[model samples]
Target: MTKKRIFLLLFSACFVFLFYRIYYHPETRARENHDRTRIVTDMKGRAFQVADPIRRIALLGGPTGQVAFILGVQDHLCAVTNTLKMSKLVQEMYPAIKALPGPRTTSGNINIEELINSNPDIAIAGDIDGQIVLDKTRIPVAFLEDGMGEGMEDIKREIRFYGTIFQAPDRAEKYVAFLERVMHLIEQRTRDIPVQKRKNVFQGFSPSHLVTLGGDTFMQERIKLSGCENAAETVTTIGKRTGLHSGLAEVSMEQVLEWDPDILVINYGKPADLYKDPQWRNIRAVRNKQIYSQPAGVFIFNRPTAESAVIFPLWLAAIAYPDLFENISINGIVKTFYREIFDFDLTDLQVHDILLGTYEFKMMKGIKNRG
Candidate 1:
């Protein structure tokens, strides 16, 4: 009798536990039936169960700001953690960015008091800690798998989601269409180029041999799209997860020598002082005088920010096949993007410089490819 009772009790407990999980599991949470499913956002095991397609927002990073504008919700943005380097459009709308502040840490992360003061309806952040911040703020925070190294599709999906949320479905559809069109143009332009004729790429982070993008990075993928081959393609090295203090992958002359990349691409802000380094001289890239310095903000993944996504591909197209799209005029691209997304015109060179990474953002975009 005791054994039978015990069995029954255990079965009841299991049933209750499963019932609780079935209802409370983050994975099973569902978004509105009207939401589009073009892009599958893997929300760290939690599905993007967007309740009301989020209106008044608080952002923990700059990308959300860009996305807000892209989705035609520049006015809907209630607050953003002020550490972001804002584009001219954002700066104009929220001049309060100069006064905004936030916590910069990897632990016990909490939302900024100012963000709470703004009384946001929704929150957007990058990590679990950011979610903790939203929890503190008492709002639902959407954590995106963000980075400069993220795929173009991932970015477009984000754009689509933001568009859906802000009731700007037309803008989102157009944005995705434009991205596809631009990418197709770039691909068609380089389709005829043979492997040998293409550039051999070495993505560098520092003049010091320590700098590198791993096999899986968006910048590396961009290089591939531009008809360039990454020197680190065959290497078995992985990079550190820290901000910009990225560690090395077994520093050795032979590894660089074996790659013999024709063009060395480093994130902008690296002072090219490596030309003075004796150790850097032995590098085939250095020897061939093929080292190229990217604009300050063009790195996307290894450097996680929104600016890189806008112009990083343009930089890749310019460097990889200078002949096809050489003049490198961003005026048209910039003008179209501004008009399409925000209905704003950024004509000031200084503003463009800051937005386009003419200055150091002090981070590298992530890697988009693995092999």
Candidate 2:
């Protein structure tokens, strides 16, 4: 044969061999099978395809990490919001969380380049522009509408969505069952109480004590489920300016005085601030020292996280009507919850910190008052 013909035969054979290795090789086919994408719908009903073996995840918006942690998928997180990264409780339990890539704020103002570098397979956002994420990063965006609806159902829906993504539906159901049990227990204890006897509770947001949740907000459902009436139920308008929470509304000091809540649950700020402030001295919660701070786990319990949805109501009921929940051990429940849901055993000190609220515990620990 001619040398040219021989060379051509060799080149053709090499091309065929490379093609077989690239496309028909068993390892290559196996990789394709392992990395295949599947369609799943987010809580907002937006359908997107995510890789089957999701190795990395980015949680945008505040406190969404609570769901991932509850599902035992915290190890898969490559990025998280600054709020979660700075959480003392989370940092203690999942030390790696502090080193994860995160945005400065939890408002969904993400740094696209930073997120791109983290190389997450999917980005789950609770409050963000989903289209911007999709166009800029080409990463599938799952919009979590977890806290937007009524109380426990909204939380259950969010957990189920994450469960589906992580292929942990059984674990999600386990958490949901716990929530139902807690709610049932609360109902059984509080059902016979007359409206006149139920506590009038006010949910105060952080930074500004005047900013409170109204009936239009999801917190109203939380308050009701706890067997208390919302003090701000009469005020239906949302606040003109955003503060710690969007559902919060600005009420006049006089209005708060008139409502005269029997108990107060503040997300931030010391109860002493209200007690000492002359402006609030006459308020029933302040005068009676009935103010209780919400707990802080992966996130503040006041937010619509799984921990909040499941535990906050019980915590609220326990505090509001100690006589009714006297036999229930909140500390024991908290310990078991951290163990089973997050797979992290809590020291008594850690549980105390969570129950006392993040800011309060930080104060107790001599940590700076960042809140």
Candidate 3:
């Protein structure tokens, strides 16, 4: 054959062989099988595909990691933010998670290089910045709605979504059912309490800045469910701004004094300082020592968590209506919650410490400390 013809033929043969290897070879076919995935529409209405058996996951923001833990799928987590690692219950239950690498913020702001290096099949992000994850990484990103300001239905929806993604729908449904039962039981017990009898509550976020729970936020719902009225429900603006917002609403100390709340619930400040502060001495809660600190578990009780949805209201109710819920033991409830959701048994002393806000995992030097 002519040299030109031979060269052409050889080139064509090589091209065909490369094409087959790239598209039809056994390795390619195996990869195609592994890539078999399903579409999931997140809370923000963004749709994305994830691997069929999602083995490794990166949780960005929101309580996606916590929800995953609740659904019994935390074993799939490969990369988690610093917030998840800092969770007292999570560290206690899964010590190995302390070594995972990722970002630290809950706003879906992550280290792209570390995240990509982690090789997570999928990334779940909070609704606020999920799009950033998609823009920055080759990994598939799914967004979950902000659970903090949402209701129980939203929590259940997130639970079901995580369950479906992890192929654990049954477990998800069981948790949702448990949440429903707990919510219903609290409602049934406190539904008929007179409004006049319900305590007026002030939720403190800090010492100098006294932020209270607004009526529209989930914290307000929690306060109401606990048979207490939010002292700041009437304030329309936060931090002197004229607009609605979720989470803590910054109010003046004068406004708090005007509301004159009967009970004080603090998340950031020390109860002792509040009680001793000369400026706060006149508040009813301070004089009576009705101040209570929000509990911290897998996550802070003040923030949203699948676990907190059940525990926060119940704990608050027990405190708000002690005469009615006197039979409920906060320690027992904490034990049962940890036992049922996490399958981690807690000693009575541990439960007591958790209630007292002293339950913390010994700080471990791990991925977080590494440069």
lDDT of 1 at 23: 57
Candidate 1 overall lDDT versus native = 0.57
| Model 2 per-residue lDDT at 218 | 72
Which candidate achieves the best TM-score against the true structure?
Answer: 2
Residue 65 miss distance in model 1 (angstroms): 3.4
TM-score, structure 2 vs. true: 0.85
> Which is better, 2 or 3, measured by lDDT?
2
- Candidate 1 lDDT over residue span 201-278, tens digit each: 776665454567656665566667776777787553434544324322434567777777777765544435666667
lDDT over C-alpha atoms for residue 172 of model 2: 93
RMSD of 1: 10.0
TM-score of each: 0.70, 0.85, 0.84
| Candidate 2: worst-modelled 10 consecutive residues by lDDT | 362-371
Q: Write down the RMSD of all candidates, one decimal each.
A: 10.0, 6.6, 5.6
Model 3, which residues run further than 4 Å from truth?
1-35, 104-108, 236-246, 359-371
Tens digits of per-residue lDDT for model 2, 1-371: 99999999999999999999677653344335454888888887788787788778888867577788888888999878767776777788888987898753536467877877676778888644455677766677888774433567877887887899888898899888888888899999988889999999987765667777678767778889989998988777454434345555677778888999999888667888778889878889888899988777777665567887777778888898999989999999989888987889999988887887873355224324443
lDDT of candidate model 3 versus the reference: 0.72
Q: Model 3 misses residue 364 by how many Å?
A: 15
Regions of candidate 2 where Cα sits further than 4 Å from its true position: 1-34, 237-244, 359-371
Best by lDDT: 2
lDDT (Cα, tens digit) per residue for candidate 3, span 268-360: 556887888899999998999998776656665655678778888888888777888777776787788778877789888667656655532
Clashes of each: 19, 0, 0
Of the two candidates 1 and 3, the one with more favorable lDDT, higher being better, is 3
